[model samples]
Target: MSYRRLHYHLVWATYRRRPTITRDVERSIHRTLRNKARELKVFVYAIGNVEDHIHLAISILSTIAVAECIRHLKGASSYIVNREHAGIDFAWQTGYGAFTSGDRDKPMVVTYVRNQKRHHGAGTTLSDLERTPDDENEEREE
Candidate 1:
């Protein structure tokens, strides 16, 4: 058997960063994301979100690329949300932030995902969150 351990911290915003994720829809979104992650064979350690964006700590298999994993999770969730909540048009932004972490940092990353509400509520903005090296390249590309 092959052995691999990969963890990633992923974040993405709603289209135009709109506050479409309200209290009534948040639970459904989280549940949909969790179910989608499972279908993709990714282990989701933690997931949390505010109004406009979300954070996820996941362990992905080597068979799937990180981008593809995010694509599946984001695509499916948006589909489910839009279908179930007809009044709300849900769509993810064009790009996402995916940061890899070592096993040693798993707990820290998970904690960050779990307490996203508190962090943002306590005045922590998205810009204040940690960025990966890829963030610079992705930003420049856009």
Candidate 2:
């Protein structure tokens, strides 16, 4: 039998980088992301978020496109958040970052995703994992 394994560390910000992901909605967003991933036959290893952005460690089947998987996760999570939480305008920013991780480094990536808040707080974040497309533009303009 043929074998395949793919994993990615995905990061994206909220629309305009607004702090829409509050404490009350954090759980809902994480749950929605995981549920949506499962529905798409993707495996979500870990998820973490702050007020403005999120990080996910996931494994996708060879048949699934990474962009499509991210689209579904973002769309479904925002939809559920808006529906469940009244008066919240939740939307993701235009672009995202997807970094591939080897099977051996999967555990480290998962740990990083799962401890996003702590990493951010302690200033221990890995820049590459934390970068979004917005950062790319800033770098070019610099």
Candidate 3:
């Protein structure tokens, strides 16, 4: 196959640690993301946001560059939030973390997104979700 589907579990925090990602804001973000994803011809398997950060489980088509797609999502959504919610100022962090997932993991990833509220409430940090022992070992090796 000349092309491969890439599923990305992407996460990013708010700019300057504003912590404005409340439930209502999250709903808006989800809707906005869905619309944009549709326009970009990307499939959004799931999306969720906590008070400080957001997560997206998406399968992007091979034609799209991961970095460029993220930039558009982040930039547009940030502007939408700032415009729609006049009282609140929102901006995304300059960088994000993305992990590739296998096709078989899509269902489980969707379930995880649905439970993000409970997970975050139970003190499961982003690192807690995606960390591997190898990462620590690599850091130590470096």
lDDT of each: 0.81, 0.84, 0.74
RMSD of 3: 6.2
Report lDDT (Cα) of residue 6, candidate 3.
Answer: 78
Which segments of candidate 3 are over 4 A away from where they belong? Answer: 124-142
Candidate 2 lowest-lDDT run of ten: 133-142
Worst 10-residue lDDT window for candidate 1 reads: 133-142
131 Cα displacement, candidate 3 (Å): 7.2
lDDT per residue as tens, model 1, 22-135: 886788889988998888899999998889888999999988999888888888888888888898877877688888889999998899999988988897644635443342
lDDT of 1 at 46: 95
- Candidate 2 lDDT (Cα, 0 to 1): 0.84
- Clash list (residue pairs), candidate 3: none
> Where does candidate 2 stray beyond 4 Å?
135-142
Give the alpha carbon lDDT tens digit for every residue of 15-50 in model 3. 655688876777778888888889889899888767
Candidate 1 structure, TM-score to reference: 0.86
* lDDT tens digits, residue span 35-121, model 2: 888888899899998888899999998777988888788888888888999887677776689999898999999999999899988
Winner on lDDT (1 vs 2) = 2
